[model samples]
Target chain A: MNAVADITQSRITRRFAKLKAEKRPGFVAFVTANDPNPETFREIFHGLPQAGADVIEVGMPFSDPMADGPSIQASSQRSLKFNTSLKDVLAAVRDFRKLDQDTPIVLMGYYNPIYVMGPAKFAEQAAAAGADGVIVVDLPPEEAEELDVHLRANRLHFIFLTAPTSSDERLPAIIARASGFLYYVAVAGITGTKSAEEFAVKDAVARLRRHTSLPIAVGFGIRTPDAARTIAHHCEAAVVGSAIVDVIAQGLNQEGQPAPGLSQKVLGFAKSLADAVHAAQH
Target chain B: MSKVEPRNSFRQGVDENGHFGLFGGRYVAETLMPLILELDKAYEAAKADPKFQAELTDLHKHYAGRPSPLYFAARLTAHHGGAKIYLKREELNHTGSHKINNVLGQIMLALRMGKPRVIAETGAGQHGVATATACARFGLKCIVYMGAKDIERQKPNVFRMRLLGAEVRSVDKGTGTLKDAMNEAMRDWVANVDDTYYCIGTAAGPHPYPTMVRDFQKIIGEETRVQILEAEGRLPDTIVAAVGGGSNAIGIFHPFLDDASVKIYGVEAAGRGMNSTAHAASISGGSPGVLHGNRTYLLQDENGQITDAHSISAGLDYPGIGPEHAWLHQQGRVTYVPITDDEALASFHLCSKLEGILPALECAHALAYVDKIAPTLPKDHIIVLNLSGRGDKDVFTVAEAMGEKL
Candidate 1:
């Protein structure tokens, strides 16, 4: 697993083939950068793929990630406690590039860290670290031009968000410069799964199609395989972040530590979601 | 007072760039950047949508009860000696305060955004109750963050929020008051940026919020303009209201911002005294910094660690003033004055005794200024004061402050 070489464009083909060969839907998993421990970041990137995560989004922790829910916020708080600065998240990405890298790794989270680091430095650091893309949760389409140009120059994809409330007029403007995929927030609310039945994920996905031709990946509140399957039929991919994090959070052992089951739980959940996606595709 | 309906006074001091007279700009953590920009875009469309405005208006009228009355206080004015006094009775509004005016609008916007949950922070708990009411009415899951200290002082409000189906989380951090509550709320907002709609209780927070919340609350002033005319046949010489995060003050002042002849006074709480350490007079003594989301006058240190705020009135015990108030204060369009805890208490008692109206401790600060200025004014001069909230919730706290707790 050459981390740097693995993330190169050529490797993405193989990564895509592996998922196709396994008859599993490609799963993009997002984990807040430096969560639990910044030092163990290499493990998170390497471990996630082994656990059935096809693409990994390492969330660059920010002081205010407005799109996050309590669990992710707590994850960020824990990361910040270890003095996880934007500089550190970028550094971890650079370090991760030293190991295995064929996985499609995108940086996710807020704009403040990027703003603080300056767009050029952030872009340079991200590109140098072999990050494929970046998703700034709060960057509006109107104000993303400067960021979009910088990320593109550095060969990092600038991903944009589309929500249930997003209109046709704003959708193209938001995703015009987007690379990789369009993240359609399946639920109107923040990140984290509630009752799948209560939050209409299918209606949200159906609405997202009118906006962009890019591969629409639905996220937010896709906790169950059924919910994932329900979303997969309407969208190209389904993102499961918070629900997986919740599994890791719940599987913590008596020592106030994430035990062996954390990995198993995530792998099983991802597999189920992939199965749901496969089921829907057929 | 010109027989026109109370309405939004479509004003945007911040241009397309989101500035409020150099006071408000996006000053936030990196994580919130995308979300703020997203919110800004959504708010822009919502602001221009006729359907959005109509829906908000409908909620304001049917749900929150708009156009609160403008009643002439004949007895109270005579007691003041010379000035004719009028009260814009916002206390009579549903949820018992002017806080409902903005929440109804925000909640409606949230619904339009397809947001399923609403989150807010409160000090005196009036805002919390109003937000909870909106959440309940709109069928959204509501969560309110309150300072642990405020929870103790404003117990009834906490209970009311619970009854309204809001999960009240007591933030036991920092000074354990409004500042801490705001910090906790911001943390929550950052975490839940995906699906949660942050119902800012005041005209504070980030760029669009200060401007948007002010626009929503301006209905108070718009209505006051017409109601005063119907009640008095002319615009009052003065408009006065208490300033916590300055929402009500802005609500009453925004309509009259262009009316040069109408003087506006914003009453700030001079807890103990402004000269002393015990005070919540941000404009009177504090400097500008970023907190929660926007850059505004904050009672904070150089490191942006917010300081402790003190006031006899829990509602007025906040560490920041609304951005618009800072602009108004600087532009000299309005005077930001402070009344001591003692003065506010005296005014509270005076209003209860003189007009048979028990004002909220926060509103008492506004009353205190009237008490002082009315005696020296000309007989024909009329002053319109915003009775921001009812005193029922404050009775127990007031009793304790007066050393006569029930």
Candidate 2:
């Protein structure tokens, strides 16, 4: 398996390498882009890196989010009500880039939008807008070859998600093309369904360690600080997506509008995950 | 002679990687990889086993009633004016549609693979009822995911599914149509991988499925080829079938691929008009993209968000078409055209009045296409159209459209 992404120069690779140098797992916060509204989303987005997030993952709100549970799914629906498009998501990334340049923002979602934008153009636009990487939830490694061509040409990292069911036989194909870091989905089910057992996650991380040199970031079902710490113990990064998004959803008012303290509420939750992940290192 | 050479076989088309000339490929989440691989292996083994063939043949003959009558539509032919029209009466089969043909074979595979439960996604509920019927026969627990709107529009079939002891779960997300139901079913299969088998309704989805469902369904074309020969002492000049997920179309077309003289026509649902946004003509109106675990022609916006598909026939109401149909459309071996809602409705009434056979709205799309072209073909030319399903399930929808209460 040849390495498709030479991620050594990318912000994502740099972040992972920096985390390794500090001997601490990075805390990656996940939020829906333009979630609730751009103003509320901006507050959450700008405050994320400062709130102890080492890397930020922004979801490109898709109509059909099969991999996500109800929380993230609801957040996407809320943002879509404002008619948030790929342009808005890219604009959000560009805005975030203004305040923070160090924290890598990976635009994660399904492959359809990028396919619509045409992979090459999407890679160019995503890279131009300061997106560090892209995680297409539905694009398996087999089909990733097409997008890989564009991502490679643009020097944009194309990250692949590995699940518990991604067998040893299938790893070589996936690992060959994956760059920046491997996203280890901690549970077999959709995100935010249930917390993955620590022993199971450790076993998975250990199994994945034999396959690639890329940093592994574990996500899905990491709903608590303890769960974040547990995942941080085994992987290079802890990705708390639906859990942090849940706080934002909770902070919204009854009229489906973002409340005054929405950004603070989300960042405060991110701070807890960051503190736990940082503590797990020592 | 044309410069391009003919392929030896259509069966050998989808490579081991599940690609049919860049159309079909597994684009699913990783969790279903092992299961898909396992199913592929199991299907290969079962396909080679003579005993499995014997069992499937027995079930098709006795239970589902195969060799479903290839009837010469004398009145329809007269009404059409030129082509000698023949109807492949798949509607007369058990469960009143061609859906049972695929369901029987898949349930047999599920049982052989030692799966206790079967999960399926349904649009018009024909597949759900068919699947529910098969599961009852095998005494397996069946769960079906249906769009909430479909559950409302297709109430009788929903009741029929429940009466057959299958649990029908309504998917209320994202247009609440076939695609969302398929997504929910995929999620279910991912969550409960070990104990369940996903019986995809059409020649769609990841490899093994487009091929396997087509294999289960290719019986339609195979039987048609033989039956039409017996009826007219030669092959039909053209084969026409409705294309939704393209099980029936691919099924009836696969056996006739090498028969160069037999022009194949696939009719897709053009709900209002192709020029308008409201239609289910994926191949005619959509561009190639990944959806429902396979890369194919999909009705999606520039951002790749799947748009809603509208059709009076729930069976044809999908944002994407089967990958094989997409490939076939590209290869120019098959011609795909769209028929609008009113045209199909008029054909639905025409078929009932002219032939005394009520056709499902999905099948009526094909009948409507036949109505358009049959009048122009030579009198000696034979046209075989797949009446894929009966209109029993669509009476309510039809009535509603006619401004009448059920």
Candidate 3:
């Protein structure tokens, strides 16, 4: 509707369109910004596009990440240990935009930091930093308008998460407010705790498709390449977060410092998952 | 009474969307949104149902001991030589605290909703014990999440919860305090939404919780109103209560909010001093921020990261206050003050020596404030303080603070 919205929507919409043209599902890689250390995180982030990622979701670290599982929670803690701020997360996006312009970048986290920064300022700064979308985990459609208006004015997609508990009656409200893509949390539980059955996701995605034309992205408990492939078959994209973070965790020393080649290890796993997702039948 | 001018009522808050002047709302994940809405509907229905009220009243009178005595502290009043002080004995409730008042109501709702499992989080294990006791009575599976540090400091309460047949799960994440325990409980509820009901201990969580908890615990103020009138032939001029998550304070404050003649005080735990970073006074020392599902005053850093709170009493060691308290503070309906750990400790010893009642450290914060204010008021002025909990669970922590090993 607005100039900024058009510009931001094109990045994500174009990527999904490109994937659709190739008759393949897109791969989205999620990582907490500045995790393990900013330098290594920068390296991994810059390599995601080359590793076949269609979109990048950067987590803005918060002290209390209630919706996240152990892996993402630990990664957030690691990032916070370095005193990573929201400014640092946007800076990471700016850096990634310098190297890769085509891949859509979404910043995700709880609302406290954004509320602290003021929603209008956060949306403006994020758009200036080249971020395309946002996913505030705790802000459902009911509470999204305060931030959504600012985000829409800035041309950033105010992405909404539709959970397993979102019934037919609830889907309409969520769909009406959602932009960019709908993140269908495959499981009703917190991230990485429970695996989503393929059949259940298929039915949920089908139900969502009947309501809106917006592309659906499945996340939560998508760990291995096979699981990613299976889930990507049912939606426009499959998001892999905690599993990729697990690689970074494994590459850390006992003292919690990043080991040598930690970035490569994380990027390598992301590549494998991406390859599987791209190879899946539409 | 003089001719009263028409005014807005403070009790009709938390509009259908669950807000109290931009302070309270449902700030939970999408997975819990539908369930929270369902809970809101169920609560509204139960509120309208007379049978629900009758059942809760029966349990309060027979099982949990309602209408606790309002006793005049003559010795303490004589010592202060100022206002006559009266203590509302919530410590005499079945679970040795006022936590049972809300827990019984919530546990009954859990049964009505057909939820088989009940989950809760606690700081000093008072709420955990109350939840366990209620679950044991109703034959529901109860799981209590307590911080590892709290489980150690509040070992007696942990034991009490376990003996009551509730599973006490120690949360080792973050600072292992009330906030961490709450985070873990939310995660558990999200993972097991269908069969589980989260019984929030404080009047602070998302929409319905803040309003519902206050409604359930409002019985304290209702009884206090009648008792004070019967004893002194008039309502007290001032009422005081300790505030952590602010349940006790809000419970007693809500009924008297519109009483223009009545004054209210909420005492917060200033661990060392408000000048130092170590304090749990959200109103006095913290800024407005979102935490534990509601927007309220919180102890947080510049980056909006929640900072740890410090208090001698675990029950008062929290980063955020109830949203209603935030709104009331903003509207100047109530006055909030800070009490240092030393001040509370002095009142603890003083109340025990003077009144023969060992007050909970949480309640001692209020007593400490009364010690300061009551001595300054005229002897004719009346002050009623909510003695919210007993000190048995806090004895070990107090002994340790006193540097006397058991």
Candidate 4:
């Protein structure tokens, strides 16, 4: 993407466009930034796109991840134990830029740390550091002025999440300013829960489609390949977060330490999810 | 009493879109936006209707026992030998705390919204008991989320809630205290938004809750204003209340926000000490951040993960205060203090001995602040302290702390 014309277009938007051109659904992978340490985060950061991640979500760990389930919360704690601030998370993205620059990297977390860092500076820094988008779990459309204005000004996608509990009246405002794509949460509860039923995902995707032309990415469940494939059938992409974090968690030994080759375990999960998405795209 | 800012009202702050300066806003998930907006509308309508006000007043006067005595603390006043002390007797309320006032109002609004169930998060269990009592009286399904740590500390309260017919779920996440319990309650609300109404125990969460709970609890300040005039013929020189989620303090502070002469104090728990890692002093040492919805000052580490708040009093063990209070402190209209565990504990015994009143440890934080400042002020200076809850549930805790087996 060139700075003169394509700076306004995020890697996320480009990914969606590419998926549309190929007539295939996209595969999104997520892992907490610096979950164990910087070395471990770099492993997942580079491995994701290679293992078939169309978009990468790097979690900015917060102490209170209210919307996350046990697996993601534990992952956040692991990151925080090493004092992994937003600066480090951005630095990780900047580091990833040295090797590969095509895959979209979305910094996903609660709003506190970003608020602590100052929203304008955060937006500018994220853009400068080659980050593609931001998914602040706690910032709804109504209150996102704290970050949205700055992020939009920096030409970064302010990715918003929509749940089944969202009202019909709420959709217009939600998608009105959203760029890249909309993240459709398939479950009502926190992440790492059961996958949503197929018919329900179909209805929700159809409902979300009525409001925006932006590609809808389904997430928050669909841990297995079959579930990911099922969701990818109707949506433009499938995002898996907790399942990959769980793989990282399972790879860790007792006393809350990461076992060896944790990144490879995550890559294995990503390969399976990508294969499923590609199979369903046909 | 100089410095009267005329044309000022409690409503002067918190702009049209739910903000105290830049502090309070709906920083929740998109799923909760519609529900919060609907609640805002319902509350606005209900607040304007005379019928709703009349019913709330009736329930307050008869059921929950409104006008819970503004009593002159002659003993405390004599012992201090300085300012005349008065206690806003919230401890005398039906559920034994100021928590009932907000619960009664929120439960009414939940029913008005046609919600079938009510959910709440509690640390000391006083809010849980009050919620259960209200829901039982109204015949609504009540689910109170309590931290496992608090459940262990507050065994009697857990029994009281279950006996009063409320389901108490023990939450065991993130230090298993008020913050984690609130997170669990929020998750439940997100999952069951259609049928459940989340009755936040304090005035801290996203918009409308801080405003609504403060409005409901404003009776404390309103009553103190009228009652104190009857006893001493003017507003007290200062008003003090402990700041947990800042509900009681804001409740008392709101009505007097325009009264420039009336000094307001919100005493946050300092745990062992303010300099130590274990303290709940959000605005004092902690910087501003967002958690549990609203953007407020939070006790967090370098990484912005909310740290565990330390306090001897479970009620005052929260890491964040109400957004309005954060704004007030910034505006220099209210003074926020941090009281340590030893200080609050000493005041607990002092109040018990001096006035025959067993104040909740949370309220003792306020009382402790009063003890520090009351002796410094003149006898003409009157101070009103919120006795937010009784200490009956903390008998075992006190006994154990004193090196005696309960």
What lDDT does the true structure give each of the candidates? 0.77, 0.89, 0.93, 0.89
What interface RMSD does every candidate have?
6.3, 1.3, 0.7, 1.3
Runs with alpha carbons beyond 4 Å of true place in candidate 2: A1-6, B1-11
Q: Which candidate is the best by TM-score?
A: 3
Candidate 3 TM-score to native: 0.99
Superposed on all Cα atoms, model 3 deviates from the true structure by an RMSD in Å of: 1.4
Task: List the candidate 3 regions with Cα displacement exceeding 4 Å.
Answer: A1-9, B1-7
For B31-112, candidate 4 gives per-residue lDDT tens digits of: 7777888998999999999988999999999998888999999999999999999999999999899999999899999999
Candidates ranked by lDDT, best first?
3, 2, 4, 1
TM-score of 2: 0.96
Query: For residues A47-128, what per-residue lDDT tens digits would candidate 4 score against the true structure?
Result: 8888999998999988888888888988898988888889998999998999988999988989888887889999999999
Give the CAPRI class of candidate 2: medium
lDDT tens per residue, model 1, A76-191 = 76676666776777777777677766777778876555654567878887788777778877566655675777876676767777765566655666667765677776654567
Across B286-397, the per-residue lDDT of candidate 1 in tens digits comes to 8775555655676754323356789988888988888888877777778989899999989999899988888989999999999999999999999999999988888888
True contacts kept of each: 0.04, 0.73, 0.71, 0.76
- List ranges where model 4 is wrong by over 4 Å: A1-4, B1-10
Compared with the true structure, the alpha-carbon lDDT of candidate 4 equals 0.89
Candidate 2 residue lDDT tens string, B63-156: 9888899999999999878999999999989999999989998999999999999999999999999999999999999999999999999999
True lDDT of residue B399, candidate 2 = 96
- Indicate the docking level reached by candidate 3: high
TM-score for each of the candidates: 0.65, 0.96, 0.99, 0.96
True contacts kept of 4: 0.76
